[model samples]
Target: MPMIRLPSVLLLLTLGCAPAASPPTAASPPTAAPVQAPSAAADGLDAEQQAWVDSTLASLTLRQKAGQVVFGWTGGEYVAADSPEMDRLLEMVERDGIGGLVISMGLPHSYAAKLNALQRRAPVPLLVTTDMENGPGMRLAGGYALPSLLPLGGGTSFPPVMALGAIGSDSLAYQVGRVIGREARAVGVHLTFGPVLDVNSNPLNPIINVRSFGENAGEVARLASAMSRGIRSAGLLSAGKHFPGHGDTEADTHIGFAAIRADRARLDSVELVPFRAAVRAGMDGMMVAHISMTGLEGPEAAPASLSPAITRDLLRRDLGFGGLVFTDAMNMGAVIRRYGQREPLLLAMEAGADVLLQPIDPREAVDAVVAAVQAGRVTPERLDGSVRRILAAKARAGLHRRRTTELDSVEAVVGARPHGELAQAVAERSITLVRDEAGQVPLAPGRRVLSITYAQPSDIMAGRAFDRELAAGGWTVASARVDDRTPADEYARLRALADSADVVVASAYVMPREHSGTVGARGGFPALVQSLATAGRPVVAVSFGSPYLVEAFPAVPAYLLAWGGAEVSQRAAARALAGEAAIGGRLPVSLPPRHPLGTGLTRPVRTAPGHP
Candidate 1:
């Protein structure tokens, strides 16, 4: 395979030799909010690409510019036949020329078809993107998904992305990206908001968790660069996340604001390291997280999204990132809670966000920006500048090239037999058995096996038929679901079932690292574990989300972390359970008490001393 082509500025970024950001020149009256550069000046692509972006930007009207900045989630129960919210959003595209849309969690399959229809209704073609980080099901249920990245973080042979970088196989990073890219294209997703280049140095960072590659800056940078290339080559755009860094924050932006407390100097060497690599490796866009920074703004000020100094002066001018800059979901509590249903969307634009992701109401958000422009708070020129960037981004995404797909071809493309096979293979490679103290994988023919689901049993069942796989491997499995709130009688029932079985494999699904809104894990995992812990027989804890599953419950001896709740991951777990494959994955994040992020023992099966 060909090597990844680095951006021209890679050397400066890698060496930390980037030129400093000049103080904003307030002398020139701010236009729109603040116009940085026209699409023409922004294009680093040779003359032809620059000309294309310029022509595209010039042709778009002010309404189109305003439309390009916002994307819709389209929640709320709507007309059964057609989505009322989506239809109105489409009007903004067809009548007002919106640029793109992001599909969020909790929409029915019919809703997706309606979305496809809305895209077709657009007069100026619109781009559709989704946060299919793991798989299409991440956004839409009953769709394809990979196990979370956490499982891949644990296991045996190869080092994590960090290890891969030390060897400089930018190719490995690219191959990983290729897998992501191919999977995205296969699912009709055009953009991926991942490869979280945050350099996960802090263990307590609730959100970044195993979503990041590792704690090493160079490794995170290399893999992110590789992954970005893979995504692009797959004919999609990959966005490096939290533009500056959200890794160190103890809090998650999904819930509220988090301050990094990093000065410019500290940011340069550590926090900003991965972002610099992403830009240099040609990331198509950067999503600015809702976290607050130290030197970037005042203590009482709003997030980086509302600070021109952070987004414009730092990201655009100093770092020389010229692609699309989006803010993390406008619906996030950080923006929505204080801004209280509105206003902050406009403030984000003033802060230099080219795309407003997951806005509560794109129509109203656009109108507010329009109102701001009219009121002279946001200059028309700055508005045009941001739209120019958005348009340029869409064009690069091949919005310029339209393809025809019949309804028959749609199922063939995404739901094809080959795609399923590939998904199965990836899933098999990802399953990890972190600690097999008893060495129980290769079960004897008569051994009884028990399978207990701690959380998200339904999701774990969909990817591949795990029970069937276990059955084929010559083990009898008795399966049960458990939760934190099970009554004593119910715990007794599941425990009795496990105790009766010769071996038990308890699978736990994890939450998304958000606050423990309630006291227990979803689907009563804590309760289930407590119940299972009562049984002294050999027990295995398989975590499908957090690699830290072993730490969460120290009572279990055979510990396994699948790292995600994707079908492939479960399948991989099933195959590993059957002793059909060798464990090659290791913990990507530290699991605390048991082992650090890089701990896993991969010894081969042993025979008695005189057996041979």
Candidate 2:
């Protein structure tokens, strides 16, 4: 793995401005070393790398320099190297000298081949990146799909950094990060838009639900820093994202502008804590969100991604973040709906963003920036600074030496069994027993268990795995699937089936989706589940997605927070219910007066009523 080499002058500038490093806490794992503050000689650029950066910047025209900061996107699926789309994209790369490409989705080898082809024809080495929030499997098929971070925080069958917080293991967080980094690099990804630092302070936040580590700033900061350290240790750049904070907002920026009304003091104590920790952890990049901070940027503030007050004055000046600043997808409705396509590109640059990600039209965006530089609206020096950062990042990734990923190694390295086992171990460790007032859990094996799953109609029945795991334990399990649109009559039939069961296990899987406003159970599904809990039979409510599902169904007698809808999480829930595994995870976020943060009930595994 190649390392990023910083110029001594740049290091000095950052060192002079950066905040003092925070000392590691007593609870911090031994691996949680205090991040060293920047020094002039620390990772200083090698003579050769510096010479290359100088030569590359000196040779590029203003148009080419502008292109160097614009990143293009590839579809989530495979596009043949010879396809028209590929041809058009390649032409832009060659003609316009685009600096980077973000792969939205693809198979491993096919994606690697496309990336190699693009690198071959590019004027400058491209910094290839992707949103590997759930690991490379988030975008690449056939890779291990780690459970979402929310479940990991609450307790999932998959290992998530949030689980590290629950387990209070900084070393485990580092391990998860290292595994993610290794698997990502194996699949040809250079940088991951991950370890989402959002605090998820608002339960109504449309998009950032379980993706966050937890709601507490200190836990989020500690775990996120550990993951970022692991990523850098694996030789991959980590981008701590949605700067200032997007955790407290109600709207999804992908659809429209989301605003955080926090004043500076509240922002410093809550939202900014993780970002400050990220900087101390030596994070490589900071992705600015499309959110508006009305407190800092005024009531009519520009989107944070396009506001100099938020991006430059706040993140750069106030926080002293010297990393590459990337704007979240410029084509998102939040920015495009308000500003013209070309204007946001220039505005983000003027706001001190080093990368303009996912622009609507790469060529036009490049042209707009070039025109601004030429007309003196954006200065040449400003353009050079961004270009320098891009070039330095590419060099650090070893793109300057070897731009192509090894296609043959993808299958052997990605989704390996050891990695999957690690994910499972984490998930099992994070399973939280929220409430068991009637002692209905560790259910006897002979009980007739009715498993009702709530999910979107189009989504895979996420609860089937739970049923299978329960059946394997010698329990009589009947299963039914219900979505938001399921008719009342269908729920009535499910209730009738529940009457025949000794116990009812209601599994709720509600995750965030674009344009969706809430992460709670939709429609009459909550009512149906509540009816089962209130029925004569004992009901064990299992949350497979949101940890806060209890708020909607307070009547549930026994509740277990499994934290995610993944297969591992489902299996863990089943195992916990069958006395096959202990419930050890604590909540990473506060559920208010009912179940506060760090609340979890531990249980020892006992023989089932009918088993030895």
Candidate 3:
């Protein structure tokens, strides 16, 4: 792989260490500072906190203690108090004594209200968490009151972590974490399963691509640790995830098993660097991925989340991570396909997972663990240790004092104007002009441009922001949307349309997804992008997702990378195209052979009308 072959080149691209010759000298985002000693959960517990944890753990019956380690899932949308779903969830809390919940997508007010209700019913305060990798805004896309007319409130949506990787701003990353924490806390969320610690060394990795900080382990370590600190500072627990590293694997654990074959030396140097940093940084939690590393376990590709050698020995005993250990979602294919339903939960406990997130069935999950403990398959001491950690984390988050969220405060704290501004800033700063050979940027305001958004049909938000920004500048845009399914005749039609326009702006969105299985542009997207390039019009290709897109259509004369498919990134790309924001971002990952790491061209902000 290019990542392994290009070690020397990777060192120079460390955050904040780009050479003087690189463009945009206007103070690149500050590099990560030296990490401090483990300070948060890793500090163990103060006497009062330990007492509370001990008392809480002691009070729980075997079933309740087992429930404390089993976290169920809830959709953040409003469920009437009398609804069956609410009844089921309430049963999980009241009857089974489940520890926490992993909330999926929903509105902010509804989410807060539902969580508040759950907290009120629980014997112990539930440790609410979500996969808010970007922020709560990522999952909370408020429903429209009238389809598209009246907009409901949602949380702040920042650009992806890869955008942070490209900008390399430790301060901005911290603020991203702060916004995530603040908004998440407002909605009664205590932990964000994020600041993905995966090194993103493998460009082919389908699930961890843009979710990871960057390819370089040290840079990933620095930025992720900084983000974790920011999360804790906002009074929310942060989990740096996919422990033992999910960066280098090609398969998505959501669908199938993936194995990392690196030897111990390579694993330590490349994969485990950020995790060690997280351990030292005192992150509140760590999630073990379902992927296996043969290098760590030897010969057999045992799933790390179910292997004691990886989670207990390597993570707990060897790494000394004192915080909570969460297993990756139990319902994923990596576990279920191999171990079936009930056995995985029992095995995860034995593997040393403190929290089993999103089990196939919470009732069965609780029973299985309770049965395992009774059978001595999992030790009673091991279960209690996990319960103590969970209770301590809840106490640390001040849940012991106040467990419920205020309904009125949800709208005020989430999706605040300042949070949106920060998102815009990160998006603007992260737009990297990798190749502008045609010099088509700073798109002339009066030109009749053909703007085409190439994305999955389901990516409804792909180019709306970009087109809106362009239209605001009074530019004539003959817009079209294309996906992998666009027929050849449609491409020919677009090619014909391209010839009539002065410049063709082709924006492609391709990112890591759970079941997508491949990072490359799917189906005919490469052909579609290539077709536009052959149109002879100076086609400016921009990637709103993976920066590696340039590798697929390397001949596209002009290229810009927004690093993600967020609306903020789309608007940022449009602004860069209009010269509204200075283009300074360098490549966080290499495209190989031609554009190595840190290859970016600078364009000064447009001064006056008609000026380049």
Candidate 4:
């Protein structure tokens, strides 16, 4: 395999963006000032108050003041629920006086409990935040999965709201946001750090998948604005993240430092549209990414997270966001490389970020920020500005007071009767069966069914729930996942089965990185679809990773978009296999004309008889 390399000019452009040189004037460092205790104002917050912010900052001790500006932890990911790390985390706030806490994937429920507990121990409130992009379920098991934006980005008619632009409805976006809201509020989370506004014009891009709204900048802007509607509708903070842009870059932030090299003009034309639209749509925060955009910032400086240009001039001054600004992850490679093992919380705060997403050491970081404020390196006004935004979101999420969900009945809620019914309804509605050139739907009972598959048996969990769906469904189901040694022969095994079975259903979940990759699946998938079709099986190609599989194997007479390879998708696949309804959904994104988008056939959603 060839090594992936970015273009030279692009690399140069990314490395060069820096804050223009300001002529240096000699100034002496300020000495210590008496650290006063911060107090909440007697007057209550207005319908939209900045006054509380004023008093909160004024009352904080220098150390507490710094702690208020620097967020603790990189994300929602927790270190063993209420572990020593948790105690240390509380100490950073209650004792050392840090600003906020970001709960990551592993520790959401723990975050909620600890934060609610800390409401007693700490003088100030903790701005608990999470990247509940797909809702808390994306972190914990059994949460309602809002369709990740990818599959929704592909189709016809609705055609991914990005395709619609002004033709798109903010109401529709709000409806989606409402879904996000409903899920977020149920989980006791105050903020959802997402609605990625990156423009994914490049199909081969690695990081962005359905997470992006669309390819067209205008469309992406419109759809992203819709997500803002979704965020607010849920009464949670919706953050426009990975600023200035992450989609244009190909590297994954989980592993390495990535960079975007676009010029100011280029950024405005392509990347800035959705971000501006999101701000206009009332998004509450901006999460700066670790990815470097070279010339866009000060020379020899780090990512926009710590760049004065990207945060202050562009976000606050020019765009007038006035909202909270955040860094993607203080623990990521980009920040880690510069900081080494030590925490650099003060730099992030001074760079204009109101909240730090995740950090390696909250105690040290909070102390550094405290020392910065005491030393007058960071201003009180700037610190308060960030705190106010966080408080507003907390108020909206009803986090300050006790808001309880029946956790005892949490089991009943997950895949609950009502939710499952809703899922089945949406499933039938979303089924987009494209390319039935030979009319594979509505198969008769006697037609033998051959199922060929691909999976990790990992992302889906240690045990498989899919087998249960296949076993009880009254169809002879067979599956094989692609791996280094077995994939080639598995194709033959599938073909032999396809030859015997009256209809052949082939599913693919090749890899995690497929959604925006140049080539999808392994090298052999197209061949597998081809060979199966050659066997004269009515090769029904089901895309579990993406709905765009038709582009790769248009020769297969039958194709179905399962969206993702989750339990919901599996159930939908079985229903589609049984021809439960027509594939009514049109393709949301474009593909080869041969495959055509918006290809599913399904019955219209039925209204409840008694309710009607």
- For candidate 3, write residues 416-533 as lDDT tens digits: 7777877788888888998877678878778888888887765556788788888777689888988877788887788778778888888888877668788777556577667677
Worst 10 residues of 3 by lDDT: 7-16
What lDDT is reached at residue 175 by model 4? 46
Q: State which candidate has the highest TM-score.
A: 3
Ranking by lDDT: 3, 2, 1, 4
lDDT of 4 by residue, 1-612 (tens): 001222222110000001012212111112211111111221123453445455555676666665666666532333454678667766776786665666544323443445555555667766666654433344333321233312211000111222222123344445445444444444445566776687765555566644565456776776677656655654556777768877677666555566777889989888888888876666677888777777565346477777778888888787778667877767776667676645456667777887766666766776666566667887767766666666654444444444343333223222233333333434444456665777666454444566656554323321133445554556666555553235567667766666677776777763224222332655566787876676566777877555555566657777776555545556666665565544455555556565333334543322321110
Please give the range of 10 consecutive residues that has the lowest summed lDDT in model 4: 10-19
Q: Which tens-of-lDDT digit does each residue in 125-188 have in candidate 1?
A: 5656665444433443332224431221100111123323222345545544554454344334
Q: Distance (Å) between predicted and true CA of 129, model 3?
A: 0.7
Q: What is residue 347's positional error in candidate 1, in angstroms?
A: 1.6
**What's each prediction's TM-score?**
0.79, 0.89, 0.92, 0.75
Candidate 1's displacement at residue 10, Å, is 47
How high is the lDDT of residue 579 in model 4? 55
Rank by TM-score (best first): 3, 2, 1, 4
As a TM-score, model 4 comes out at: 0.75
Clashing pairs in 2: 76-105, 150-210, 151-563, 152-163, 155-430, 156-427, 157-427, 157-569
